[model samples]
Target: MPELIFRQPDGSTQLVSAENGSSVMQAAIRANVRGIEAECGGACACATCHVYIAPSDLLLIPAAKEEEEDMLDGVCAERREGSRLACQITVTDALGDMIIDIPDRQY
Candidate 1:
């Protein structure tokens, strides 16, 4: 299992273990992480699971698919170079430890 560190808006952090092949959003949901709403339930149709991946870990993630990019345009927070919908990020051994920052709001 890989570990995910979620930095919340209030500056609190929650560390959770993620199963391989599960989305980061799934791990957050299971851990009751506060900021990831995941309104569409990891379907990639919503931007509620938005997060910013740590820059150092960026290369470990695959490029976002076109559909994910489209949905990203609707995210509530400002989209940046490292912004990603957590549901689109699958956990893998290669990812090791990932630090994701949750935005102040999801909607």
Candidate 2:
């Protein structure tokens, strides 16, 4: 199992094992991490699962798709270079031990 490190808004971190092939948002929800709402249920329509990929881990992730990029415009936090929809990020061995920073708000 891959380790998923979730960084909370107050700077606290929670480490959880990610199920194989699950999205980051799903894993967070399963763990009841509290920050990711995933209102669209992994659908790209909502940016409720917005998160920021740690700067150190950015290159490992694929570039954001157009739809996701567009939806990000609605996120509560201003978009940054590392911004991404947690639902679009799948857990993989390469992404094991990944670190994701939750934004201040989910809407």
Candidate 3:
């Protein structure tokens, strides 16, 4: 299992093990991680699972697809260089111990 570190808005951190082939949003939901609402259940239909990837980790994952990019535009928080939808990020061994920051808002 690969672990992911989630940084919440309140400055707390959570480390959760995510199985390979699952999305970050799924792992967050399964682990009851605060700040990751995941309202659409990893369907990519909503932007509530928005997170910010660290610059170092950004190079490890694929760029957001067009649909995901479109959804990001509507994110409640300010879109940033590393902004991404957690539902679009697949967990793999190569992404070991990656850190993701939950935006201040997910509405």
Candidate 4:
């Protein structure tokens, strides 16, 4: 299992554990992490599961594909350099510990 550190909009943090090969969105949902709404489940259709990757850990995963990029454009929060949809990130040992930043709102 890998650990994910989610930094909430209020500057608070929630730690969620992830199973290898499972998506980050799944871990957050299972752990009941407040910021990952995942309204579209893991289908990559909705940007409700948007999360900002810590720059330091950005290299651990591949960049967003075209479909995910399209959805991200509609996120209610401002999109930044490290923006990503949690549903697209699969937990792996190489990711070790991921620090994600949750935007202020998903709706």
Compose the digit string of candidate 2's lDDT tens values, residues 1-107.
99989999898999989987898889999899878999889998889999999777977778889999899988888789899999998888888878799989875
What TM-score would you give candidate 4 relative to the actual structure? 0.95
Candidate 4, superposed: residue stretches over 4 Å from native: none
The ten-residue window of minimal lDDT in model 2 covers 54-63
Instruction: Please provide, for model 1 over 1-107, each residue's C-alpha lDDT reduced to its tens digit, 9 standing for 90 to 100.
Output: 88888999888899899999999999999999998999999999989999998777889999999999999999989898899999999999877667799999998
Worst 10 residues of 4 by lDDT: 93-102
Superior candidate under lDDT, 1 versus 3: 3
Which 10 consecutive residues of model 3 have the lowest summed lDDT?
Answer: 35-44
lDDT of 1 at 96: 65
TM-score of candidate 3 versus the correct structure, residues matched by position: 0.96
List pairs with backbone clashes in candidate 3: none
Best by TM-score: 3
TM-score of each: 0.95, 0.94, 0.96, 0.95
Model 3 spans with C-alpha error above 4 angstroms: none
lDDT of 2 at 1: 92
RMSD of each: 0.9, 1.0, 0.8, 0.9
Residue by residue across 1-107, what tens digits does model 3's lDDT show? 99999998788899999999999999999999988888888888889999999887899999999999999999999899999999999999987789899899887
**Of 2 and 3, the candidate ranking higher by TM-score:** 3
